[model samples]
Target: MCPPEHFTVEYAINPWMDTKIAVDGALALKQWASLRDTLTDLGHLVHVLDARPGLPDMVYSANGAFSVDGTVYGARFKYPQRAGEADEHRAFYAEKTDNWRFFAPEQVNEGEGDFTYLPGAYGGIVLAGYGFRTDPAAHAEAQEILGRPVISLKLVDPAFYHLDTALAVLDDRHVTYYPEAFSPASQRVLAQLFPDALLADRSDAEAFGLNLVSDGRHVILNTEATAMGHKVRAAGYLPVHVNLSELKLGGGSVKCAVAELRP
Candidate 1:
């Protein structure tokens, strides 16, 4: 995880960002540190990525790249503001990891932000979100590069720009997401794919409840998602709350701060 030492909402890419509200840098750092520590305390190996001086949004490491089975598909950012991050992430993986094959696709894609793996009986299914930051064409590229079946899901909500912000993979068969964020066709596809998935209400979704990460048991989510927390607990998962209000200023939360290396 990269510290939010340089995090600020200087530009508005998503609806959540408001440049008028001054972000408390110190508080952001504290919250980020707490999140990192919490993940480590949960017995997960946390790796620190050095944050660049100018790339403020680099703290949202999940957008950097998508790693699966030792192969890293470097991100091709849609916005110029975050374009430089792709190279930095590629270099890091190249220099730090051993035997890691990297694929740099020309099409626009926001790495893990749009690409999420669904593990189950139909394991290795990649749910790729598009119509926002990611281009729909990249789904085929991802399938070819990763050698996995890709299901294209069209995102319709600006607030849920990335799939991670709208959908949370809780376990093999279950997922939690805001139905309105996706297109009607995509919603039908999701229902067919995950019939028993938990559906979050508008209030919970506005609180960024679906922007979570789970270890199949413990779910880490935004503190404001109280109702969603109760729902998660009822679904047999421990909901761990973390206050990332400052980070929310950048249209990101718990899942955005993390980049999983799936091996």
Candidate 2:
């Protein structure tokens, strides 16, 4: 079983999001400590990003960028208010690990939360959720850059604006997603790719419950979704739930809290 404290964290400081549910100083600190404790228990290398003063809700936007093929492609967010986030990540990319690279598209595209990797034995496929975060052209650009096929889909729900917020494919064949958020065309494409995807119910998804981290039969999920937690366990995978309600208000969850660097 993988423990919790093994993750490396890089979070943005945001007071607006925090105060939404009254996530103030002590409350925020306690919540972060809980998250850190969970990560440590999971055997992940945790690294907390230094809080950037005057930055309001940058962590939520960070979920858009993802790391793939040893490169970290920063996101181009839709909200103009989040434009500065791209530059923030650019600086982080430069000073951080050399293994992390950057991909900035002149066109608009949100990165990781909008896209999920389908790692296959032969090669890998990427599912880009289009509409709010990722543009159709961005999917094509990403495919060209990665030299792989990127399947694009329309993300229907406002609450589940990003792909990660709606769906999570854990094992090679098993996937957890809110069916209502996907279009028929996208569903057909997904069937072509993942023939037998397990769908997650909507109520659980709102809590960022369906966003999962997996290592083979082992799965990591947010603690808030007790029903989904039961489902994951029923599927025969060891489930590790970490409480991150504070982070969720910032538009992120457990999946966004860490960048997985190992297979």
Candidate 3:
């Protein structure tokens, strides 16, 4: 059978969010609205995962899981509270598609948050970032399961819990990231791979909502990231920013909201 078509989206549900992880609920909801509006404007097919009772904190889905090829793989978060989330996603994927898998119950891995794909980078190599929610052992498992090389990198900051939070590669040569979020080795690797990358300074990165989506030339970001927004525009890209401060409380932005379906 052929693999199913792919598309990315974010869910609006919250309350499942850990209070420790999210400082304020009211602010996060506002951010979610901004992110939602932006995705809708961009012609993305936003699929809203049904809200589960007692799972009020479900808005942190950027860490939930992601799809690779035709198979759906759920992430194993380092946080114990999030372990049950994998089961929830497994059920969601099973209902949506037949191809479903996990990172071995014992292994740990968060999907899009820690994992990303760059089609032009080494025949579409998949880079899985570790040192945050995803464990190193899980990265190896992902490599074996996906049948592609999964490069691992350690994220340097706690605030940037996942790779996507601090760095997102928009295309093969261009990347959106905050340099402070990367370790020395990871920085070097990033430099070697994306020689023409657009690295944003801390203030601009935070203001621009750095980890957003890019369909090659068009980048979707938060309007709040003004400086970064201007830089992206200068780089010959159409930068679309929506307000997603509410969603930020759940610890993700536009990148976490939408999944991309590749041909």
State which candidate has the highest TM-score: 1
Clashes of 3: 24
- Model 1 Cα shift for residue 57 (angstroms): 0.7
How far is 138's C-alpha from truth in model 3 (Å)? 1.3
Candidates ranked by lDDT, best first? 1, 3, 2
Which parts of model 1 are misplaced by more than 4 Å?
A: none
lDDT measured at residue 11 in model 3 versus the true structure, 0 to 100: 29
lDDT of each: 0.90, 0.65, 0.66
> How do the predictions measure up, each by TM-score?
0.97, 0.82, 0.82
A best-first ranking of the candidates according to their TM-score comes to: 1, 2, 3
Worst 10 residues of 1 by lDDT: 116-125
Give the top-scoring candidate (lDDT).
Answer: 1
Give me the runs in candidate 3 sitting further than 4 Å from their true place.
Answer: 1-34, 98-105, 261-263
Residues 36-121, candidate 2, lDDT per residue (tens digit)?
67657767676555544444445443353666676655678776655665676666666766566667766677667777776772
Q: Residue 111 in model 2: shift from native, Å?
A: 1.8
| Candidate number with the higher lDDT (2 or 3) | 3
lDDT of 1 by residue, 166-263 (tens): 89899866788889999999999999988898998888888989888898989999898899999999999999999999999999999999998886
What TM-score should be assigned to candidate 2?
0.82
**Model 2: CA > 4 A from native:** 1-21, 61-64
